[model samples]
Target chain A: MTVATFEASAPFHIPRWLAPFVVLSFAYIAVPFIGTNYLFEAILLPFLALSLAGVGLNILTGYAGQVSLGSAAFLAVGAFAAYNFNLRIEGLPLIGSIILSGFVAAAIGIVFGLPSLRLKGFYLAVSTLAAQFFVQWALTKFSWFSNDSASGVIDAPSLSIAGIAFNGAVGRYIFSLTIVSLLTFFAYRLVSSQTGRNFIAVRDNETAARIIGVPVLKTKLIAFAISSFIIGVAGVLWAFTYLRTVEPAGFNLDRSFQILFIIILGGLASIRGAFFGAALLVVSPLILSRLGSFLFGDLFNSGVLDMSQRIVLGALIILFLILEPDGLVSLWDRIRKRSVARLNKRKHVGRAAQPTQ
Target chain B: MSGFDWQFFVEVLIGGLLSGVMYSLVAIGFVLIYKTSGVLNFAQGAMLLFAALTFVSLVERGVPFALALIITFAVMVVIGIAIERVVLRPLTNRSPMTLFMATLGLSYILEGAAQLIWGTQVHGLDLGIDDVPFEVGGVLISQFDLFAAAIAAALVLFLSVFFRYTRVGLAFRAVADDQFAALAVGLRLPRIWATVWAVAGLVALVAGLLWGARLGVQFSLSLVVLKALPVLVLGGFDSIPGAIVGGLLIGATEKLAEVYIGEYFGGGTESWFAYVVALAFLLIRPSGIFGQKLVERV
Candidate 1:
């Protein structure tokens, strides 16, 4: 594929990438207006929330070269913290509660990230499992997190901002879309910035990064902070917008693996890849179940269907690792490159004919 | 609070030590695969579940206990070889992260396959050991615990001797020490890997039987491996003895904490206390006790 270089003197010209993204953004905004309620609630809201979590994980694991298996812990922390902040503090707006929850999750993330300074590879990953189990335990053990609910489940308070209630599926979808878009925009800028370069350097080689004047420890911690902040917000969206009722059990080890799979399947370290991974994770099982029922009628029981889903998911992960480790984004890139090559060949032929004339 | 009951403490310690041997059994499987192939085999838990489920299901169908055990062992050996051929072989020379993820994928496949083959209902696995507690020196101990410990000891002894005396054992050690050197010496990497996986699978079966006897063969039987993570971290991932000693320590500490410290946190701290202990230990000694010092060259 050829790199598109913009002239330094060019003023106020949008990049070619922005054209497709702009159209996509408009369609995203129009979804609530044009699409069915089931499409908005059953599909898009959860996808957006999980996509944001995938983006957060991609920053730390993909860009910074850290493998964490405790992302669900941060999600749980974010959700519970937001719930507590909203419940205890009177008259505090939902936005403040959400941002506060993000900060809280970031702080905890930095604390857990400290072990990364000494541990590397699978060792660090195992240590992160401590956070996963510990967070889950804490949330369940203490009734304070769940507001002392008998069932240990907490309901999200109605979301409203500046006298406008974002309560229904449409409102929640728009709210989640706005939050995801803004966070994704920030993530794009962060990945391209000097700090982001430091993250890449640290991930590629910590010793080399340090020798070349990159602050390795700080870079790692910052990656954790930013990633957790985004993930925490995703957690808030997961609780308040998508599920609407939160339980600690919902954010289990499996959930963490699911998010990790999203980044892996979507294309690690790419912002667009997070969304792709989330969409696939959310939509594929539904499609697979539908196809399974249609194909086999009553022969395919739910238990068998569930088992098949897991087998398919596992096979897909292995296949992606073997065939395209860079994931679907790389596949898309290859296709685009081939088409671009063909277009350039046609253009060159046309120029040759014109010169002959 | 009634001045610490010494007898109760001793009882808890003894019970914890016995169960720790069970954890060690699972941890040994991890060490074997990791030592040979450098893969952290997260599927060890799933293997344990599959082994136990198969054995129990066979026994349920009126297969004698001994026959069921033999058949399960054969099935596990086939699985070990199949996994090595299909998954590990293709993904050789990848980063540890990639290998780790493959094991994670392997785990999902194993879990799903286990449930699909043997329905998800919980099953009772009786190894014929009586569960009645016997008193010795004012501390009560379960007869089953003693049996489990004996089995664990025998397994460890057999493994140590096997690794020390046999020709294949020498090849295994050589491969574990340096894969490239082993390859230069014409040792077939695939054969060694298949052997190590088979050994690990055998270890998982023993662990599964013991744990299944204690807790019943259920979906949660697989989750016992989570408790073994602390044992691996504390003992050092690559050391066999480390797994044993680490397992004992985690088991004792977990019981003691659950009995004493759990009250402050409203009980049930055993679920995560081991992980916290392991995390703290990692902060102090990143390589873990008895683990070879990792020397990184830039």
Candidate 2:
């Protein structure tokens, strides 16, 4: 089906949520002007990068019905590819380097996605760990990736587009925000199209999707490629814009789990859920720390607090999976539906009273 | 080629085989859980770490070795039952992926709890066996390696007998074949699942002691699971025999590759070698060497 027809037939109208989403987008864009550098640098940049990664993962695991535990591998590939391209290729623009890195990541993604044709479910998920370990090993073992640095840590060069250097917190924020917004828009459009329908079909039932002429293998590969490309770009943003330097260790298995957790907690099969998940993951730790210090004062140390945070995070993940498998987006949708019902009842009551008068 | 020593190669092969048995110890836990419940228990590594830490900590507190072992076993049983009740029971009828993710969450909880309780300090676990290398047929072998292999062999023998002769064993096999059919026949799935998890926990404890003795009880003990993944993939996830054979194959090949070919790659090929091997094996037999073939219906 066409994107327009799909949207028209959707149970929930987009227009109802469009106003608040627009306002939120504007406020996000305006954050640099109104907020502190700490907010822009420490929080917003990482959130956007993680949100983009969540979006990438959401497309594959959420819509396409393939679970990957190696997204950080793609992210590592993206960051390193971008760094190498900018370093070796003379006169290559930074934007070109980042985009090229995405293509590089997509190529590797296709290679790893090959097994998904033969494997299903958790078997496929376990297989993806090969990608995770292999990529990290390659990046660490081969000194060339780090430009033969003894420490194996590489600094991301300043991001510049035609002499416009995104060197500061605000500059990096705007640059990442623009990239995320554009990619998110494309992701939304793609998911609403016939291709998106194919993903959902394959996810719901692969054999049925194949019988319906969905080209199951090709669809799975495309999902992998697209997901890798977006995640790869996020890696570039993470390394160049947020952290400004990285080692392979930075994108280890924990990072992969964190991104997966974001998508799970946000909502599967929803674009907006990626952002919601990212926000929760990034902000929750800050809130937890604040709460810990407030309640315990000097009684609890930072290390103890860190352990407590992990326990809380773990518990929350299990709780969400058991209680609200659809994630925060579905929770928000439920609340919205209920409020709308209550508002309609109030309006009907007012109309009936006026008629009686 | 001229300087290639046949003796060293033989020694390496023997050493790899012995170490492979240790990996089999861990992979067996995975197979037990997967066979009965169809859940890939990601928390197996964390359980290993927890079991090892608890045992070592108890022993360090001047408790007798046998007492410490019993207490650790009891703790694992409790944890297994608690998990089966609280996590897996509520998660019944959910997709395998959801259950897998829940196990991932369980891993985090177990890891955090282990560190919190045990103070995150690395401890050396001595199983009263000296690890000094002893010469055998012109090859150097560790006494500890021989001990580990013996323990693994005994565990396997005992498990095989338990599965064959016990009433619970019959129930386990019935459930593994068909959960619904077993339920129809008056078998309790929750109890069976709990039993399987407890068996897995017991396996983890044995693996933990052996691994901890070799590498010292540390956080990195959890990473031994990575080495076992190749074994799991190679041997089919649900087959006990697969875990054993796959473990041996992975262990031997990884060591051989490291010793012979690692020089070309500047060493450290052992880390990813098994995964690459498993990936290649998947290309040939997607179900693994002993895993049941996957059947899908529209």
Candidate 3:
């Protein structure tokens, strides 16, 4: 949809309204025209889904100030819930199953979030782990969740909203994009609303928030519920849109850590940070491995190279935490402010002094 | 399965306590750092793996066992001090969660470096202790488990004495009791932290050696950290004896549950059983059975 209308006064030049149009066209039209299916399948799709998960996590850990290490469990619950909904109920639309799956995940999240009332910080963190372990155990142990498959992996049905089939890579990418944008919009609205302020209040200090009449318990539960709902939707995207086959094993402790790292490295308490973090989390390893092979191509085999890549990844996480605790988004903000300030100063001087790089 | 078996129950209880000792060993590493500093050191598992791998690799390269032990200990001291200097010192005044995440990051670095230095093949660490079971009152116990429990007891005794008698130990207790007060009294916080981490590193070495022999020095060695977390939750994060008792309770309950009712849950309940136990315990006592009660203020 168009966000702004073009002005006739700027007809000869590109109007402000046309800027978003140009970007939208580039994203939807120019990308697929120039890029291959490999790019869509390998990179774009996963990036959107993971960023959505990061947003989901940022709601709880960043905004609510509750540290959780069991996000992957909720993701798995959503995927499996969607899978079951699609299977059990006949004639259900693709969107129907996805939304229902989110509710299911939210319910599980609330159950896990129950402990937050009694526990705080590291104690609560460990309890969330119980949710992680138990959910994975149930998913893998009960073959019924997998539709009686011994392998415990499910083949997600093909996606068709209304009459359009999103069976191809571009189709899936667009579907994921639409869903992510819609959910992210709601998340932005949610965080800015009174509910969002309560989240911040509780995060800052539960006792203070209570003194101010914010229902501490309710806010935490709502944070968990909303966070899980979004994460669950991301799970559906991860399973149905990105991966060919969905399995419980796909969402592990490592995946939880990845989402946590995304928020940590993206800067906590920011919406756009999730995107920056997701992009880096998804792309950095590929860059690291490629650079490793390029530099030490003949010296080490794949095993040694893989190990080195991990070392670099680990080192990078620490370096980023120490150097940029606010995340890459903060770094971006600094550069943007500096450049904009320089531009304004030059305009006042009436001389186009070359901006410092 | 039909009748209540008293003999089997005792045997399982004994075995669980012994395994609990192993867990307490790892938890001790966490407690050492946490007692002196509020940071929940998640890298304890990785340190265990690194120390074990270093020792086993040295021995593999024809170094004598005693020499390999000394070399591994020295390496652990250097790594501990380096971590304190680089990671812990800069991150000193951060919140517990931030420090927790940093240590989580540290785990990655340590795990990666350990595997990168020592090739990824699994190595069997032979501590030369026989695993044969000896029957006492018609209950069988593994000799190796008994040996590990004894070592854990001795280590606890030594630590208790050190904390009781030494000047540095008194400094550690003072810092643990109240960091700001200790600082006001002119205690050297960094040196004390370094010493604490070095001691933790040594604890990791001892844990590494024993666990390496039991589980084989492999990538999964780091997973022992998971076992220690529940132990920490049960025992309280900052208490040494809390760790020991917590480990025993968690170990015994999980084992009993696994044997008695595991089939109902389709078996393999051990993975999450300790966590479930910890969660249940948390509902009753958030700080743990013996952990210092946390007080919050505006």
Which one is best on DockQ? 3
Better of 2 and 3 by DockQ: 3
Q: Residue by residue across B222-263, what tens digits does model 2's lDDT show? A: 888888888999999889999999999998998999999999
lDDT for position B92 in model 1: 90
DockQ-based CAPRI category assigned to the predicted complex of candidate 1: medium
What tens-digit string does per-residue lDDT give for candidate 1 at A201-257?
A: 998888889999999999999999999999999999999999998899999999999
lDDT of 2 by residue, A90-199 (tens): 99999999999999999999999999998887668878998998899899989899999865788989878889998999999889988998899899999989999999
What tens-digit string does per-residue lDDT give for candidate 1 at B72-113? 999999999999998999899988789889888888888889
Clashing pairs in 3: none
Chain A TM-score values for every predicted structure, listed in order: 0.93, 0.92, 0.91
What are the interface RMSDs of all the models?
A: 2.4, 2.5, 2.3
TM-score of each: 0.96, 0.95, 0.95
The residue pairs found clashing in candidate 1 are: none
All predictions: root-mean-square deviation over Cα? Answer: 3.1, 3.2, 3.7
Q: Per DockQ, what order, best first?
A: 3, 1, 2
Candidate 3 regions with alpha-carbon error over 4 angstroms:
A1-25, A350-357, B295-298
